[model samples]
Target: MLDNTKRQDIKVILQQVWGYEDFRYPQAEIINCLLNKQDTLVIMPTGGGKSLCFQLPALLQPGLTIVVSPLVALMENQVQQLQQKKIAAGLIHSQQAKSDRKLIISNLTQLKLLYVAPETLLTPPIWEKLLQPDLMINNLIIDEAHCIVQWGTTFRSSYTRLGVIRDALHKHKQNKITIAAFTATADTLTQQTIIKTLRLKKQFKKFVINPYRSNLQLKVKTVWTAKGRKKATLKFIQQQHNKSGLIYVRSRKASELLAKWLREQKLNTVAYHGGIINSKRRAIEQDWLTGKLPFVICTCAFGMGIDKSDCRWILHYHTPELLPEYLQEIGRSGRDNKPAIALALISEPTGWLDNEDKQRSQFFTNQLAKQSKQAKKVFEILPSQGNILDIIKEIPDSELALGILQNLDLIQWQDIFNYQKKSSNKNINSVSTSQQTKQMQQFLQTKQCRWQYILSAFSFIKEAKDFKCSKCDRCSLEKPSRIISNK
Candidate 1:
């Protein structure tokens, strides 16, 4: 009756079920990319309606949407959200009860979307099962697709097997299945890896949103001791307790200790980190989801699959190993489109992790050179732009070297990206590239506006412009304990 003949089922689902009347920016574009049957790589920033790009298309397309997620927490968050809308979303992860898993798979023949960990997707049995042509998996969606590319610092070994899974899925396609890859963070180097790692065709469709949020205030402070970190962290959280906030640390033990210490000061706080038992973590997540918890202190393990759209503040206790990781952390805050604050708690951390940073550049450079056998020598010429072939003569296969370069995040290609070989050069510039990496290291080392630099790396330039935010550490060094009682 409503021109159902040509109207997409997703438009109906969004209106009738999810209670939405419109799609966000890039949602329609990503859905169209899938409808056209092209492999796509999406780089929409956080809170930028990434889910609809896959969900709407999966509903419109013929078969199941098999999603490869990086975190178990994300799987839970997405599954619950879908179920709330009465959409048929299922999950396959280690945490699913065996009976539940069987039921989901049995009903999977009609499943609109099925989410699974990439690690689970790589198993031999799973590979065999996905090979069935009649099984009807029309879409392959890899969330956090950056993990597969080398450009992302938080690389997971599971992502490497996507190529294997892709090849197998293609072997039995009765109807062409479209692969959609999505992530929030990627430099030029990572943009290339998303397509290459998934083993998609060289000419993949791309949707890249400039990573910028003008509503957030960015700040960085350099402190020398753990006590300084706690004093500063507590002060900030108290000021904004009326709104949502998150504090991140490196260790699980640190998360628990900090949570306990904060509550001792009589704050409405809870802990969320990987070291907690799964049941406890779920409870914490649920509590936060229901708005029962006002603030949380966590580790890097948090926020992977979170859908909370109300966080107003995020703090980083220390800088991470890579820019991609930093992007993921900051992305968690301000999902509601309101003004928020992001803080990086910087200090010269001692121990092995520090030493690892000192040599990490050389470590990755040598690894990439080996992988890009022919391109090894050609990487030396700085600021010299050339084709992939000119560069790949030293490191022949465009595929392998691209994979290695993607991991290192050295260079990104033009839109409609192809892994080309570059011209010959005198040497590789591992040191210079590593020096650029020091931008992140110096972020920790410097006392400047850390937020501006972090946001800019992902190309969020205007958000950092129009200076004098007046809300950062640089704005209030001697201010009183406004942390509490202000909000």
Candidate 2:
């Protein structure tokens, strides 16, 4: 419904700013939805131009657009990109100098887009500025929207409180704020969870582009022993030679050990994880981006908002616990629309000889249960209504407990700093993570076309049916098995 003038203006901006002559599949429509002041949920693939959809509309609009992102690196990367385009974008993260953050806050009206982490968004200075009457805000965007459902109930509790943003910002009848949630991967259940948790309007525009990336070849190799697993990973990396890519491991410890071993093997790689200092992490990212380091042995911490267009491959040292995560990680490859491959190594069918995946699943499941029990205990002692700041002082892990309670609908946040307990008949279930892990395990063992299974798992069932991807290992009979045998 974008009229001629508006559409033409957007097209001009697109060419002038991003150098894109035309909008990708649903990008034009999504931008139009936001320009019309409608809430939107966009499920587009990683390289499917998700950012432009919101970024374009923000340019065409009258007021500042706020993007709530999950990682510091992501926000910084995005803000940097916008700045390179000569767009006035700013990000407020912990890494920024105090004076820099203050100046940005004071000059908010000058910015087209303000990127912030969910946790940082709730802090007093930023929150107060947002609540100010003089500020003219237009859209509040949630990037990596799946994290709300995946991590909201556990560690990133601030995401659960984001529903208040809509109500708080829209207090004025004239200052309507549109919310748009965008992510590369989300199943039907995840989509519903995002819609409900973010409290998107009933008539919010939903655009789901079937997350089928035909350019990325999907393959899984089975290893029968711990040594076989190591050998297979090394062999795969050796095959890739000097091609830029990422090797995803499950733990910081593993990242360190594997990275060291890979270096000993004369491979250009390094360890990357959240535990590393920001400067070092930034350096590693820069090296990878510039192809100085061909690959990095990393946990899930790397590659959120990075734009390495020619990344040729992705190797999973440990199988991901969830299908969505698998999708998101592999999505890092082939951003330039060229061919790429994602190879995941799993223990043989029995998991008797090599059980790293089994061990990881058990460790995470146990950790979830322990956290749930602690949260429930804290919930029992918490007053019916209390300030989160005060409760955090009196109770250990209260924030996580409150997040779990809020996620279960057992507690309603009256505001960012306060909550009201609600009666709940059912207990909090921690088995959800375990069930998700099982789904990934099933995916590894499935004989069907890997891409087809992915399409079906992500709710593109109609496309999945009779969808035999000739590119996958199953459908391509000429390619020999890559399985690393114990012998």
Candidate 3:
């Protein structure tokens, strides 16, 4: 029941302001949902027109659309772009000047949109204003929704206060003020967390477009050392030119070290981790957008709202612990329909005291990485490479141990390298534990359909009108494969 005339009205506004016509597949559905004044959750892939889904809905709605975000630099960049289009927009994060924010608040009722960080959403006056419909109040939006999960390191404690944001807005409007939460990476668990934290109803509809990118080829290489991984990364970049990419690592030190190393080899690149100041990060991001830099080697902190659509290489120099995060990072590339590749260069756990233990997993415990400290040392005892029995003898309880290391990137599986029955019927250890280990290893070495494996895990498939990648290793080796229905 989406009205086509409203879309044309939006297209005319878009052309006059932002210059665009027509909506991408899910955009109209999102717009129609927002129009219905419902509380909605949008699970979509990166570059699937997520910003437009919220932007156009904000424009068509009667009052202002207040967006709650966590990325500060992203807010400034997006607000500036909208302002250039002559759209009435404002940003009210903590970093803004006093007078500027005052002006924005004064015109809140009349402005089209306002981008505020979670910090601002907690202010007393901000909440007081929201309690009145006379102020700019039509819809409430929260971006980067996965951060709300209870087990997220990226989690913002203030996000738990959003139940107040909605409560105040609803107190005034005779109608239920519309609410929509959007994210490029969130599983069913995280999705449920979003609704619970925001305190919405089971009746709230869900729009989950499965996590699948057709034009991407997934590959994992088991290197023996950090030195080996670096060599592989440089060689791949040399083979592909005029193509953009992302390289992720566990430590800020690693991010800096790799950028310096890549530059030493004459590749134009920069390091981007959360440790940098906001202004510097903004400057670096601006340069990347304008083509001044070729690659960004970053920690997990980068790429929240970046709109780079032409990146072709997404490299994980180390194996990422969480599969969903890995999915999000690699999905950043090949967004423009060109062939892209995700390479995870990895090896077994080294008997060394690396700083990885301090960087991640402080707040969250992934399924693959939940075990006791004694069990984890088994990773070192198993040696860099070993068979299942070899692993079990060292740890004695590898089911718990191996899962921890796999989630922590201390060990990674590269295909079902080999399997042999020791006794006449020892059987291939077809128990659930072995099956899980086998599957995890398979993900490390899958060469079938590029997008099917990941989506299948989450019960998602690809669409017919999606971008296709004929040059990917899988597509090159086989006929086109049909991913299941994402809807």
Candidate 2 has which clashing residue pairs, if any?
A: none
Query: For residues 334-445, what per-residue lDDT tens digits would candidate 3 score against the true structure?
Result: 8886778888875644513342432343323332233444434554455566554455554566644543343233444431121122112211121122332344445666
Looking at model 2, residue 118 earns an lDDT score of 91
Model 1: worst 10 consecutive residues (lDDT sum): 478-487
**Each prediction's TM-score versus the true structure:** 0.76, 0.96, 0.76
170-251: candidate 1 lDDT, tens digit per residue: 6677677777888888877667656666667766788777665656666776555667778988788878856877787766
RMSD of 1: 8.6
Per-residue lDDT, model 1, residue 85, is 77
Give the residue spans of candidate 3 off by over 4 A: 1-8, 150-155, 172-175, 349-442, 445-450, 461-487
* Model 1 residue 88 CA deviation in Å: 1.4
RMSD of each: 8.6, 4.2, 12.8
**How should the candidates be ordered by TM-score, best one leading?**
2, 1, 3
**Per-residue lDDT for 40-102 in model 2, tens only?**
999988888888889888887887999999988888888889999988899998888899999
Clashes, model 3: 3
The residue ranges of model 2 lying beyond 4 angstroms of the native Cα positions read: 478-487
lDDT of 3: 0.67
